[model samples]
Structures are given as C-alpha cells and as structure tokens.
Target: MLVGEHMTSPVITVEPHATVSQARKLMQDHDIRHLPVIEHARLIGIVARSDLNWPSAAKVPPDAMPVAEVMSGNVIAVTPRTTIENAASLMLANKIGALPVVDEEEHVVGILTAADILSVFLEVMGVGSGARRIEIRLPDRPGALAPAVQCIGSLGVNIVSVVSAREQDGWRSLVLRLATDDLEPVLTALADLGVEVVSTGEGDD
Candidate 1:
C-alpha cells in the first residue's frame, strides 16, 4: 500500500517560534509523540516527545526555549506517493518513530508512524479473522505452490490470504490463511501432494 492510504492527515504542527512548553502541551493534548515544525507553511524540522526530554532541555527553561532550538533540523520526510515498505525502511535506517509527509511544495500534509505500519502488518497477516494459518516450505521452482493451492481448493476450503517469501537454499515459504478452522483435511491433502508443512495454527480471533 502507499503512504497516502495509511498516513494520518490534517496533521497537528508547531511553528519554529513556539516555545518548548507549548509543544509539550500540544503533544499532551493530542496524545501524539511527534510534531512537524513548520515555517512559512513549509516543513523545516520535527520534534518528538523524546526530544523534549533531552538532557540539554533540562538546562533551559521550557517556557523560554523555542522549539527550533531543540527540534531536529535535519529532518527525514516522505511524499504521499511513497510506498509503505519504503517508508518503513527509512524509519528503520534512521531509528525514527515517525515521518513527516510533504507535498511537492514541501508543505506538511500528514504523518506516518510505526503504529500505522503495525496495523498494516496485522491486516496483511489476517489477524483476528478467525481463520486457520498454515505455513509450508516449498521448492523455489515455478509451479511448486500450485499443488498445495489446488489441493486446498479441491477440498472446498476457502483461502483467506496468502503470503510468500524466498528462503535460503533455494526454498520458498508460503503462508496461507484459510476460512475454515478444520485444518486436518487440508493438512492431509497437502501431505498427499508431498508438500512440506512447516506449521499450522489458529489465527488470532
């Protein structure tokens, strides 16, 4: 999915001249951890809850210190068109919890946080869907997954979701979420096709 689809819009922002005390109050009022610092309607910096707690912050009076002095000027940002995967990688590489989403004019539009990505992950994994999860290891060659899919389909089992990944040693991993809770029949069908079943369990309810 794209960042635009998941990012939180109508973002709450702070001006560079705003006091650190005001920034802290904004965070407390909105229950947010990050704030994009705006200057002349453009994104210039960003501040986080952790930034407010910096050791240097303790040396100054919050009411007298401007957020600009404590905010990170070297900000990392993303565009709405950016993919969720790429945004996630940026956060990981930078050790950041949030990213400011900007438009072509560099106007702050929205924000993406680690929480949003976690929600996407749970959705992709079919969590809380009351389905049966089956993980299998298969050969990397083409059509290797066809037999398992065909076997499950022939048995009238409805597949909810399917995820695949390449593994080491020319192996591929396939995870399937089935609508039905009865996995014994499906397991038997896959085993009959000589498929290697890695694990099976009930999906989160």
Candidate 2:
C-alpha cells in the first residue's frame, strides 16, 4: 500500500515560535506523540513528546521556551506517493517514531506514525478476523506454495489471506488465514501433501 492511503491527513502542527508548554498542550489534547513544526507554511522541524521531556526542558520554563529550542531541525519527510514499505524503511533506518508527509513544495500534507504502520501490519496479517490461522514452512523455490494452497482449496476451505516471509536455510514461512474455524481437515490435507505445518490457531474474533 502507499503512504497516502494510510497516513493521517489534516495533521496538527506547531510553529517554531510556539512555546514548549503550548506544544505539550497540543499533544496532550490530541493524544499524539509527534508534531510537525511549521513556519511560514513550510515544514521547519519536528517535535515529539520525548523531546519535551529533555533534561534541558526541565531547566527552562516551558511557557517561555520556544518549540524551536527542542525541535529536531534535521527532519526526515516523505511524500504522499511514497510506498509504505519505503516509508517504513526510512523510519526503521532513522529510528524515528513518525514521518511527516510533504508535497513537492514542502508543504505539510499528512503524517505517518508507528501506530499507522502497525495497523497496516495487523490488516495484512488478518488479525482479529475470526479466521483460522495456519503457519507453514515451504521450500524456497517456485511452485512450492501453490500445492499447499491448492491442497487447502481442494478441501473447500476459503482462504482469507496469505502472508509470507523468507527464512534462513532456504525456507519460506507462510501464514494463511482460512475462513473456517475447524483446521483439522486443512491440516490433514497439507500433511498429505507433505507440507510442513508450523502451527495452527484461530484468529481473534
């Protein structure tokens, strides 16, 4: 998915001249951790709840200290069209909790937080879908997954979703969410096909 599809738009922002107390209030009111610092319609910096907790912040009066003093000027931002994967990579590489989405003119359009990414992950995993989850390990080769999937399909079990990841030692891990609760039949089918069954459980209701 794209960042535009998941990012929170109409984002809240703070100006550089805004007091630290004001920024803290904004975050508290919105129940948000990060705020993009804007100035003259441009993204100037970013501030987080953690930034407000800096030791220096305790030394100064929050009402008198400007957000610019604690805000991170070296900001990393993404665009609406940026892929969610790329944006996630940027967050991981920078060890940041949020990323501001900007347009070509560097105008703040939206924001992507760790919560948003986690939501996408849960969606992809079909969590809380009330389906039966089956995890299997397959050979890391073409056509390896098809037979297992087909075996489940042949049992008249509806597949809700399929997610895979590469593992070490030339094996691929697959997590399949099946629509039915009874996984015994599906498990037997896969076992009959010599597929390695990692685990099976029911998804959250």
Candidate 3:
C-alpha cells in the first residue's frame, strides 16, 4: 500500500503567525494531535499538543504567543506516492507521531500517522473480525506454497491473506487467513497433500 491511499487529506493547518491558543482550538475542534504550520502557503513547521505545555511557554498566555515560537521548524514530510512501509520506517526513525504528505512542489496535501499505520497493519494481518486463521508448516521450496494454496482454493475457501516467513532450517511458516468459518475441508485437503498443519482457530478481533 502507498501513503496516498491511506493518508488523511485536506489537512487542518495553522499559520505561523496564528496564536498558540488558535492552534489549540483547531486541534480540539478537529480532534487532531498534529498541526502543520504554513507560511505563505508553504509548510514551515509543525506543532503537537505537547509542544504547548513547555514551562517557559506557560508564562505567556497562548493567545498572546505566536505559534512559531513553540512549533518545530524542522518539519519532516512525505509524498503521497511513498510506500506505506517506507513511511512507517520514516516515522520510526524520526521518533515523530505524524508526517505531512506533500506534492511535487512541496504543497502539503495530506498527513499520515502511526494510528493510520496501525489500521493498515490490521488489514494486512487479515484481522477480518470474524475470519478463521490457519498456520501451515511447509518447506521453503518454490512449489511448496503452491500445492497448499491449491488445496485450499480447490475447496472454494476464500483466502483473505497469505503471508509466509522463513523458519528454522528449511521450513517456511505460512499464515492463511480465510473468510470461511469451516476448516474441516481445508485441513483434510492439506493433510492429503502431507502438509503439516501447525494450528487452526477463529481469529481474534
């Protein structure tokens, strides 16, 4: 998945000259934690809720303080076309909560956050609320997964997700999330193919 496909668009913004109190109101009204600061239609900085609680900042009422004083000017932003995984890595590396999605001319178009990444993670893991999960142990050979998948496919089971990872020695761990509740046919088919069924059960919500 790409950042553009999941990032929040038409982002709420605050001008650098805007008062900290105004920025706080925007965050409160929109229920957002991050505010990208714009200057002359260009993104110049970003501020988070925590940025408002500085000890020195408390001396001046927020209404009298310019947002630029507390906002971080070293803004780290991403593009819409950036891969979801890459965007996530960027967040981890920066130790920041959000990234502004920018256009070719550096125009802020959207924003992505760790919360959005969590939603993507749940979808990728096939936490389909009521789906069933099946784990199979297969060899790392190229054709190993094909036969097991073919077995489940032949039984008309809708595979919601198919992810594999290398295990000890030559083993490959296959996690299959299915749309069906019944696992008898799929289990039997895999058994017929001599595939080792590691585990099977209803998915946790």
Model 3: per-residue Cα lDDT at residue 188? 81
lDDT for residue 83 in candidate 1, whole number 0-100: 99
Q: Per-prediction TM-score, please?
A: 0.91, 0.92, 0.90
In candidate 1 the C-alpha lDDT for residue 191 amounts to 84
Note the Cα lDDT for every prediction shown: 0.92, 0.91, 0.88
lDDT of 3: 0.88
Query: lDDT, candidate 1, residue 157?
Result: 89
Question: What lDDT does candidate 3 reach at residue 24?
Answer: 88
For model 2 the TM-score comes to 0.92
Task: Please give the TM-score that candidate 1 achieves against the real structure.
Answer: 0.91
lDDT of 2 by residue, 84-151 (tens): 99999999999999999999999999999989999999889888888878889999988888898888
What does candidate 2 score in Cα RMSD to the true structure? 2.2
RMSD of 1: 2.2
Candidate 3 vs. true structure, TM-score: 0.90
Residue 101 of candidate 3: its Cα lDDT? 90
List the candidate 2 regions with Cα displacement exceeding 4 Å: 54-59, 202-205
Lowest-lDDT window of 10 residues in candidate 2? 196-205
Return the top candidate by lDDT. 1
